[model samples]
Target: MTRRTVRIAMNGVTGRMGYRQHLVRSLLALREQGGLDLGDGTTLWPEPVLVGRREHALRAIAERHGIEQWSTDLAAVLADPSVEIYFDAQVTSAREEAVRQAIAAGKHIYCEKPTGTTTVGALELARLATAAGVKHGVVQDKLFLPGLLKLRRLVEGGFFGRILSVRGEFGYWVFEGDWQSAQRPSWNYRSEDGGGIAADMFPHWEYVMHELFGPVRTVQALTATHIPQRWDEQGKPYDATADDAAYGIFELEGGIVAQINSSWAVRVDRDELVEFQVDGTQGSAVAGLRKCRAQHRSATPKPVWNPDLPATERFRDQWQEVPDNGDFDNGFKAQWELFLRHVALDEPWRWDLLAGARGVQLAELGLKSSAQGRRLEVPELSL
Candidate 1:
């Protein structure tokens, strides 16, 4: 079997999501598994060069992972002719320019979303990458998730006949630093730093809704900074200008309505940190991060609406747990592997820079909807 090493310049590995999800669980895990087999006996191995501003953190991460390359010089890394792919998990505000540079340097681009703070920036990057003739993709990890995959299977199998609505409940209480430190980074509460629930989560919702149901047609949203002040990493109080909570109702192409609540202030009462309950004409399903439960039309119990007395029926027991019929891999790694193949073998892959731009468009429209206090139509990008 022929094994070819694909050099990747990975920026922002020092950040939380970058370090844990992309670096450790995805890239390193792929390396430990002896790289990805290309089905035709050839294997594509990832050789990552860690790039970040913090020298100490980068060095520590590289050394811990037994990686030979770590550098603070992003310019030097991008200039390297040997680097085939440039992956960014940097802060949202810093992503556009870096990705532009990578595209100009003739490198395949893969990054986390929202691709940029604005739709124009994201679309421009897409155009630049396409004109440069370099492969590009964005991290749409939720679609690969076990629960969502199961939901997709159900949808494909005609379990949900004529899907009607999808309700997503996400987020948990992030403590203010007075007593317990905030679970999220301090910048997440600062709008100036490209932080907010809408910016962070609307991208996920965009792809999820698009991939599962159809493209989003219109959006009506409400956002609020419920906690105006919060303590930072240094135990100093700072004003949180960004919205911590966002309520959105999206209309999909197939007339499917998707309502999602994203918040850092709300306490979780559901089965998981995030759950999507989808109802259709024939059945209903609730999918969390790892598990999915379905109630088919035959099994759905009918109960009379009674206002006076307490209901004795166990409503939750009507649904059956969806079994893990096959081994489920890490969603991040799964997408990473596909991206790697897309770069190495020119494989057919759909989640490209255009898709990323669409995500950014949705986010921008959602924010606009909130500001204008009206439903806004999502227009398709001309480019």
Candidate 2:
């Protein structure tokens, strides 16, 4: 049997997102079968090379993973004739330069979200990758999430006919490092690091909003920095500069109103990490990261305002324990597999830089709306 292997060079191999790519995604992607169900035992895999700063750190990481190759010099990695893909898990500030280097080195690129700290830089990287003729992709990881995928199915199936509105409640309190360490990385809480909930999360919403209802037409938003100060790992206080929370309302293609509240300050409400409730003229549905609870007109009671009586119940019992119908995998990991399959079978893969740029645009406009204290129209992007 002929075997194909992709030689990968991974940047930011030691940080959180990068660590996941290094230990989890790369480790799994490099394995045989890669969590795919094969009737018989067989293997499909890729070879990954560690790319990052600090030689001792890289070398130690490689030894721990039993990986043979390690490198501190990105230039050297790019110069290496064997590397086929350049993977960037670098910080937002460093992502653009890393992508440029990869494109110039003539390597296919797969990297994390936002693509760039600025919208223009993100678009430019896409252009460079296009001009360089190397395949490229951004980690639109949210779309691949199990819960959101389930939500997509419900939306596409028209479970709620003629969608009218969407309500999203997301976030949890991140520790201040005094009692417990912050759940999110320090960079995510800083403005200089290109960090902010609106910037980080609006990208996820851009596609979901587009996929579930339709493309967003306009936005009115309010952003906040709840925790003005935080302690890093060393317990030293630093001024928190990023918005920890955001409330946004968007106009979908069909005039549907979609509201999103993303925060890092609120405590979890239920077992659900995220909850989306959609109400239509015909029905309503509520979903979390996995299962969905829904009710239709047949099971609902129409009520009008009355004076002295207590209100009665309104909708059908939730669709409890409705099982998922497809293969279950972690969101980011699943995307990695899909990208690889696209590379192998030439299947249609359209999660391009355009989608990424749109995300950046949404975040930018969101901030704009907040700054101006008015609604901002979302302009269409060039395909």
Candidate 3:
């Protein structure tokens, strides 16, 4: 097999998600596995050119990973003729401009979302990539998770006969930077920094609903800044201007209602930090990051509500666990492989910029719905 190398200019490796998921687990993991087999007579190897503002962090990552290239200048990296792909995992406020610059430099785009701070900006990025005729994709990694994959399998196999509703619980208590350091960055709680639960998580929910159930038709939301003040990375107090929690009700096609509550203030009670329970006439399933359990109509327990009696039914034990028939990969890595193939061989890809734009649109409308105190229609987007 012929070996081919594709240079990928990766930005924002200093961030937690970018460092852990994209750089280490995904790309470096692939490198360790001898790159990707293209199913042709060719093996595609990814050569990463780490791009970031911090020279110390970038250099440390490069040296630690045995990477040859690390740059503080994004322009010079983008201008390099050998760099075929541009990957972004930067903050929301900085992503649009950087991505625009990358697209203009004729590189294939693969980045994290919300693709832009606003729907309009996201759409513009999509249009620019389309017009430039570049292979572009967004990181919708949750769709590839083991639990969601099993859920999708059930959906495809008609396990859910006439699906009723979906209830999603996602979040964990992020510590304030006082006694204990905050888990997330301080920017996440600042509106000026493009931070909010609605903007950050609604995009994931949008694609999950759109792909598994149906397209979202309408949305109703209530947003709140539960914590008004939080300490920053330097242990200094700052006003939290963004909404840390969001409760959303989404109406999907085929009369499916999805209610998801996203919060950074709530403590986790579920099996996973994020989980979705889908109900239907035939069966019901609860899926988390790696586990899925289903209770069919035949096996579902019957419970009676009583004022004086203590609960005796083991509701959690009633559901059967979904077995993993095959080996599962890291979701971020899986999508990275697909995107690499799409760029290399023009593989059939669906998770493009437009799909990302739809996610951003949902977030935009969701925030609007909260502000207006009403349900807002999600119109179909184009171009």
lDDT of each: 0.93, 0.80, 0.96
lDDT of 2 by residue, 1-383 (tens): 34556678888878887777545664545474553322234233667798888888888878877788888889998998888878888887888898898899998888877777778888888888888887788788777767777777777787778889999999999998777888788888899988999999998889888866789999999999999999888888899999999999999898899999999999987658888888987777787877777777676656688878876753334344445888767677777776766655655777877678888889999998999999999988774
Lowest lDDT block of 10, candidate 1: 374-383
Candidate 3: worst-modelled 10 consecutive residues by lDDT? 309-318
Model 1 C-alpha lDDT per residue in residues 1-383, reported as the tens digit of each score: 99999999999999999999999999899989999999989988899999999999999998898999989999999999999999999999899999998998899999999899999999999999988999999999999999999999898898999999999999999998878988999999999999999999999999999988899999999999999999999999999999999999999998999999999999989889999999999999999999999999989897999999999899988899999899899999999999988887898999998999998998889888999999999998856
Q: List TM-scores for all candidates, in order.
A: 0.99, 0.91, 0.99
Instruction: Please report how far candidate 1 places residue 239 from its true position, in Å.
Output: 0.3
lDDT of 3 by residue, 120-210 (tens): 9999999999999999999999999999999999999999899999999999999989999999999999999999989999999999999
Off by over 4 Å in 2: 25-44, 302-321
Error of 2 at 73 (Å): 0.7
Flag clash pairs in model 1: none
Evaluation by lDDT, superior candidate among 1 and 2 = 1
TM-score: the better of candidates 2 and 3: 3
Give the TM-score ranking, best first. 3, 1, 2
Best by the lDDT measure: 3
Ranking the candidates on lDDT from highest down gives: 3, 1, 2
